[model samples]
Target: MMGNKILRKIVATVKSESKGINYFSHQSTAADSYVYSILVDETSDISSCEQVSICIRYCNSQFQSQEDFVGFYATSKTDSFTLYNLVKDSLLRLGLSIDKLRGQGYDGGANVAGKISGLQKRLSDDYPRALYFHCAGHNLNLVVQDACQMSPVIGDAMSCLNKVVVYIRDSPKRWDSFNTLLASHEEVSGCNIRPLCATRWVLKLQSVDAFLHTYEVILDFMQTAHSEKSNSASMRSTAFSLLRKLEDFTLYFSLRLLQVLFKAVDPVHRNIQSKTITIGEVLTQVSSLANFLASNASFIASNAKNDDSVAHFTSCKEFASKLHLNFACVPRGVRVSAEDYFCGLYTGLFQTASESILIRFQAKSLQMAENLRRVLEDESIEDGIIKTVSEFYDDWNYIDILRERRQWFNICRHEGLQPSINSLRTQFKSELTYKLLLPNIRSALTLYIVIPATTCEAERSFSALRRLKTYLRSTQTQVRLNNLALMHIHRDDFIKKVDLDDAMNEFIDRTTTRRNKFGIGNK
Candidate 1:
């Protein structure tokens, strides 16, 4: 009971500190109170109750980057305007002004991203400085989704993979049988498989990797289950159906193609997902992925030359993926040759992926970011670039920014430093000269760094909520859950410095009855 009391006190401190009184920049001080950005994402908890999680990304007084969870607000209405009001109220509660917001980050969902009626559009009406950039991580996820949906064969392959995974894993006896078969096979790497996911990497690439590894083991498992007379008719029927689906050369090829595509896409996705990476680094990753897609399309086009024996090898029969036994490239009874059908698929896949990335990443956002890179580049900035950047900022004048942008570029060139956001951020913090010399440029640099690359912090908050709030604890108040979530999600920031006794005393002082009982007076 004492341990529980102590634990509660400690977490309560997490909630108190996370209200962020110390982290808050007083609006009165220009230097300490920096312009910040927000990352927003929504999820339904176990009870199917919808809630929005808000996190702020900004540079601290020490000029170090911070992405901290503010709070979660449950809402029945989720349209652009209502969601904005919820966000506005949440920000008001946190003592942050909407006018000071410099950037907005969210997924590609229409509710948030729609230019006409979306939350981004509504927020811009209120504060023009809050430029919305689609989350870079979600952009990559959408790219993969677009590529998969472009082809019907690939879609069916994905569905087949999901069905097989669910069917075998749903029954304990079947799961045990599958693992036993894996144990007997010395060649299998013992990697596990899972369902494919749209929003996360969890159900995606690694699952494809494991499935590719245990191809023959799976075939044997399916064949044995179907052939056994003692097995349930449903099990036999399912096994037999999936066995045929697996033997379809098109399905096999499509899955392999997906594995390779995701392999290329995952690295870029990982780069965007990393909190340490700046938007500048993320933009570089975007360019790199584009180049890979271009080259991969060429590689796929060149695969048109493989003949029957080369594609369907009988010698290496143990490895089923490598040795193709069936070559029916039929879709809905429409027969097509493997060479013609697969060649189109392999080439068209990356072509669609490249197009999706280009469309989804948005030229306007890229141009906005690239214009700032001019401050770190060798090029001479003219009046037009200054006007565009200043217009986005909406701070009344483009004249002062022109001078700062020029001087900032000169400083970078004079120092012979690489032109990156991280490099500029380090110099700005370490050298007091830069801050005093170019205040406008400093503000721009600070705001640029605060602009979020991803909403992964908000997603992480949801994950912490899943652990802290379970089915049995469904009756707990949302405010209490929010407080606990603040402690659990941002525990690393609080673990070492926070004192439990101080937190409990503080909590007691805030309450009228507790203060009277403890005989503590307000300072």
Candidate 2:
């Protein structure tokens, strides 16, 4: 009874403080298990920033018609209708209208991304306004993966880099020796080798950076291992071959190219993972990055035409300087000039990556993003605003409120207020939420604010699930697991908002006999 009271109080606080649950991120944890997380915008009383919290609605393994807990079910089948029905039932049980859902985020999978019979397609049939987007971070990873795979030279170079990390990590002696050498070098002291993971593309950047930073130490360790009597002949042979490959000019050129390309996209990648970022901002960053890469390709091609060795070497030095690589150490046997290498890399890798990003992000998603951008930027009632209202507000009916809003917008502009969306929202939050405002206009604005630009929140919940349901606690019941996971994930909220005195009073009221028996007194 005490726990039930506390749970009700917490839910009440969330529902009262939040305007509405605007977006949901869903992911399947196992073949038979799934989790749906709710995200809502909570205004901070103390600051201007809005906080996003993940309320875990369902985490279970039961398959039935109308099963409780906001739709977690276990089933043998994996089809679009099954998933859609689960979500629909869950939303209905929560008393949330399907019409209010503005966005859906998921991993790029056939069951989710398929155009004909996918979960996204099925959901769109009922809620055409709810947009489906593949997770932005995952798309960036795909870009890197595709670019690397398209070039055999880059692939082989990455393999060699991975092999180097593995060779040292697999043996304690070699690993210790590498560390010892690293410490002995003053310039590279305290640098640790980073292992590359196939699934995590960001680690590729770290791996390459670590290798370059500790190059001399790694080379020294490899030479020592080659001469060690305890080392097998095959091990020595492999070490010698790897050492030669690491020193090759072509490998360094490939590394430099990848480093530059990753550097360009890394900022945008990090930005999209943020729960607070809007789709408009993400699209802008992506478009800018694509353009940046295109210009870089053109620059490389232009430089490739110069045949003067002095000029060629200067270009090499300039490129290496940006990556902090020692261009003087590049071997003479690599006859391909730096410009030629960069041109090839730009054509084979960066250009394809840029094109791939634009291709994968759907045209409809881009159009919506542009509409939001225009709404955020424009100061007056323009064609873009009309287009937005027509496309998003067909069901809305409060023209008087919209007219008032337009008048307020003009007044703000006349008073010299900046025309940015954030500025407008900040100045007119009350008007936007007033009862007189058209419900459709309010809904559109609120949805734009709360629509998740990424599925990072869902991914984070999956990570928490893994930690909570580790091998040692694998046999715990689903209810217990769900409670524990919620407590752990929302510890911040519990610390900040939960009142101990109220909970204790409720506990005392529910267990009077136990309280009397223990002679416990309330403060």
Candidate 3:
């Protein structure tokens, strides 16, 4: 029963390895060429312990962008004052200079993103160049969440789907039963079930799509559970209620509509997660998606039957033609015609998504980032725009700014070279104002490149958080947990480079008995 004396040493060695690998990644920020951005988000552990994740995005010596999980801070208070101080101390510990921070991104929590006293406001006060923007990915999720709020049917359907998936997955017998059905049912033989994510709604697309394909099988399973006479009365009642909700036509249509709608927003949502995606690019992609939804809304509106004359019912007719659908009651307590209700719902979804996107993206924080985009992609050079760009980086010397502007116009002449911020950084080595002499231009470009567009990577670290700090490992110390999380999030960046044999030997002398056998300090 290796009661784990040796296992403890292995864990200790892994913790040391995590620390060494993370410190190595931290050295990238020590570069004279590095200007980094901060991404901070607070999440609780399984034990409900609140901690903040601090990630820094910067371009490495290779000029490739990196968003590295740098540290975690545990604190009792999450107020902006406490959080701001915690962030400062964390950076100081890592030996990263506050002067090098060029941007800051976080979700729209009032304590974090508020203009007056929020963390962003505090950060921008001291580090003016650390411009703030609402995280683009969270903004997209908010768009989906806002649209979901508009339709009660969507809310109800989400509840039903989420509960049913959890109900089955909670019990091993139920999960195994569901798996057996998936294997046997021909309509969705190989399909899997995914629970709807509670935090980010855009991620719910996969969960919704999975259940849609497996809907029939789930229905069959529920039907058997409800009808089985030997089942407990409470169990049968619960199963019956869930089954009725599943069988509702409104819920089914909501699921179907959400499938298509989520698919519509998927591309923009996905593109926003990129490290190099600027606010301008995200706005462009969002505008395109909004236009697509608008077109679909128009099609749906004109095709559905209305109170006037005869209508085509093109979309509704097409969808309902294949399967039987019931005319369900709306919130007003009257059963409406299938042609009108579903079409209106479909059009409403498109309208909701488009409107929410347009409204939410018009934030004041994005104005500066948009200005940077104009300088990069816009052919017509405007002095006013140049002033805005230079003012954003007001820390730069005036002479350098003047020269960079000349180099900038010259670079703009080669229209073909204007693609992405990253590509431009690469192209600059040879042609940035006559042999890359523009140091300010290079640094400015690096600054904008490192300014993270979204906090998606920080959110990704939360998944690792759950994996590393499960209930069984709940007793792990905070330092140990942080080390393990940094290693887990950044394993690919440094795992292959770790010298495991040396790491083991370094941690081999933990216990006195083991040290005696190893002859440590015997000489």
lDDT (tens digit, per residue) of candidate 3 on 1-523: 1112222333232222211111213342223334677899989988888979887776654445566776567788999999999989987666666876778889989999989999999999998888887888888888888888877888988889998998779778778988997898777787778789878788888999998778777888888889988878987898899988877777877887788878888878888888656556677898898888776666433454332112323543344344344445555664666556766777777778889888988876677777666555454657777677777676444456566656666765666555456556566644534323555555556555666788987888888889999999988888788778766665665554567765555566566776677776422
Instruction: Judge candidate 2 at residue 314 and give its lDDT.
Output: 55
Which candidate ranks first by lDDT, i.e. highest?
A: 1
Point out the worst 10-residue segment of candidate 1 by lDDT. 15-24
Among all windows of 10 consecutive residues in model 2, the one with the lowest summed lDDT is 59-68
- What's the CA error at residue 390 for candidate 2, in Å? 3.1
lDDT, model 3, position 320: 36
lDDT agreement with native, every candidate: 0.72, 0.59, 0.71
- Local accuracy of candidate 1 as per-residue lDDT tens digits, 1-523: 2222334543333233222121123323442234677899999888788979988877654444567777778999789989989988877666566777878989878999898999999998888878888888887877888898888888898889988888889989989989998889887846676776755742388878888678778888899999989999988999999999888777777777888788888777776776656687788888889877865555434454233323432222224445454744445664666455666677678778888877877757667877766644535666678678777775424676667667776777798876666666677669867766666666666656667788888888888878877899877888788778766665666544568787777778887999999998775
The best candidate in terms of TM-score: 1
Task: Identify the runs in model 3 with alpha carbons over 4 angstroms from their true place.
Answer: 1-34, 166-181, 299-337, 395-403, 406-423, 429-435, 499-523
Return the clash pairs for model 3, or none: none
Residues 97-141 of candidate 2 have per-residue lDDT tens digits of: 566555666666777667898877888778776667777778778
